[model samples]
Target: MFKTRIILTAVILLALVGVLLANMVQRMAHLHQSDAEYLRLFKEVVAITKQSYVEQVDDKKLMTGAINGMLAALDPHSSYMPATSYDEMKVHMAGAFGGLGIQLGTKDGNLMVEAPIEDTPAFRAGILAGDHIWSIDGKPTKGVPINDCVSRMRGTPGTSVTLGILREGSKEPLSFKLVRAIIKTKSVKAKLLEPGYAYLGISEFQERTGEDFERALKTLAADNGGPLKGLVLDLRYNPGGLLDQAIRVTNSFVGEGLNDGLIVSTKGRSAGSEREMTANIGDKQPHYPIVVLINGASASASEIVAGALQDHKRAVIMGTQSFGKGSVQSVITLRNGDGLKLTTARYYTPSGRSIQAKGITPDITVEFAKKPAQPEKKKMPEIREQDLDGHMQQVGAPKDAPAASEPSAAPMDPKEQELLGKDNQLARALDLLKGVNLLKAGLK
Candidate 1:
């Protein structure tokens, strides 16, 4: 009876295996058939274009265009970079390059300025974020690929490039002639706001950004004479760079106990593309109130840092909504020195939030506003007691007794005043941090 039962189970298992094999074979056949059909169509189109084109096209150019078109169809971030463009990209990632330091992106088929790196030509030229790039050097940039536009803008350090920009509220397109320079970006800048309050600005994430950030934090603490009481992490106009650097920056503030130190995760169709990056065992900041500032220009890695901190409840995000760019790109270098920047996966925050098209909403929504210039003080009519018609001296008071002077508050640092004056969002962040510190003290 036992042998009979075992035989029946073996027969059932064999039958299931046979059915699974058949399905696998059938799917493979279908996949091959579809691939073959599309390949044949592509070849036919290429042959026809080569034979009946207005101008004689090089074979290499035709192939390159085809590759670019395929990648462009997939997404904006994915692109095929030729050898020269690939080289330029590598240099840019190395934290220095010769160009007008404006990060570019596409919005609704229009070329848009993502952000201008601080102190660069583009930033000094007043090239604001969200400005539509209408033309480059007087040539229309309507359908130009981003790589091509970048090439046109980049040249010798001393050379000039003119960009025609269409601003949101402006009636006419504005022209900006800027001289390109060797843009060596210092990723992090730190300052002590007050006795324990601090401000740290991350302009862009680069290869050394993590190290720079750590150094900046230490500098801030030293300048403040101790650990920070509160921090305003300014990520405004910071077009994100290296992914690992972003994770490292986020890891600095997050402790091992929070979400198992998971900073971010990625999901893709392929098993190899999916990944989870967690913070290392140590390297956490002191528990303090933090306010992270982001604007429309903060994207990719910036969004990652913001999302991670937000999910952990480690920082209060304050500003306008972020520039939603959560795609993870993998750069594959070809043998011929060319490269392919492919969007392999979409990253998620620790809380399982995919901020792809939907950005990280700030806990406190603050719009960008410039502090209005102080109006020139008018000369007040001096009506002193001695100048008044019914002025009378006290019986025992000295004639020249100095008026009782009120205690004056400490004067603000000129640099801090200038920075806060121009940035309303930053000012609000400082206020919030101060309030948080006060509230914590009160509760204790």
Candidate 2:
């Protein structure tokens, strides 16, 4: 009986202290003062109110609200995550967890798929990466948190879920029925392109991106079983995930020694004091010419790889401009399982080129303009950033940029995106790799 009474007393005391401390902190923002005895009385009243309040109140929720409100008052990006949210975040960073295998994000109140993982139910059912998600089953996912929506999409394998998909130019959303499955996303995919050339595609940079990429390269080399000719690294729709992965990708082509430096840096807190990540050249070194393909949708970690290769002149970059997401984000976890993913630093290439707003420019720019297609008479939705290019949020670039300036960016009157869509850049990159192979062979 005494132990139970002691436990109850401790909880009550903690509640009183929390209430008192919160009130005290509020006064710091303004001008209020209090002393001991009356302060104790105020805390006592607070405890009584909390214990006997007519309506139930979640103390934990109230505490979280206070913390979030405090941080949000400072800046737009600064926010808090709760415990439930923290676990969901693990899936994003690690890139494996229960999911529908479709990468969904919002750009203007519309839920859109950045891309779909290969071989997942979503991908198998003919769901394209750029397909927009209108609803889960029949309920609208609009205004829902991305994490919460993702959680709703995930369940045990073999569980079926209905999705309403909206693609560009479709007036009505399409119905897609998918069974939840364990999607083992392969960060790297490689195959021999012709006899001497190899083609590699990185879907997303993860902890194992380098390992997977290296494994693919080795596989290609074994299949060739001869002096390699060239290589093509394809980072088309990869949104990018980790920094270490980017470094490894760059190192693969740069080779050991000869300081064909493949990194970019920026002005730091001190002169020449910027964080420098040098290329760790590969032993195999590709043993031939190299090419890298990047589109306007490649971003962050992807940009890092492309930028490094371009800087070192290790690979010829052939494609349109890249997605200018040069800022580096850091996820800071809280006491509660939630975390704050904030842009901690702005990244630059080893050549000191800042990718912020201005993405990596290709060495040989291959502009992809839309081609004419079958005329559709449907009235299209108002053109927006998302409509122009999926995952290519080229904000902070040169201002006064005209809408539909790049023909490949959108499907306008008299033209469709066959001129711009579906590994168009990758195909061109493969052609570049083949050319390199032919040139090397000619030299021999």
TM-score of each: 0.69, 0.59
| Stretches > 4 Å off in candidate 1 | 1-27, 96-184, 256-259, 371-411
Candidate 1 local lDDT, 136-175, one digit each (tens): 9999988988888988998889999999999999999899
Worst 10 residues of 1 by lDDT: 399-408
Reference-based TM-score, model 1: 0.69
Task: Look at candidate 1 and give me any clashing residue pairs.
Answer: none
Per-residue error (Å), model 2, residue 282: 5.3
Tell me the spans in candidate 2 whose CA falls farther than 4 Å from its real position: 1-85, 98-149, 152-182, 258-273, 369-372, 376-424, 440-444
**Model 2, residue 291: displacement in angstroms?**
2.0
Q: Residue-wise lDDT of candidate 2 within 263-345, one digit each (tens)?
A: 64433343444466776554746446666777778887888888776666666777777877776656787565578765455
Collision count for each candidate, in order:
0, 11
Best by TM-score: 1
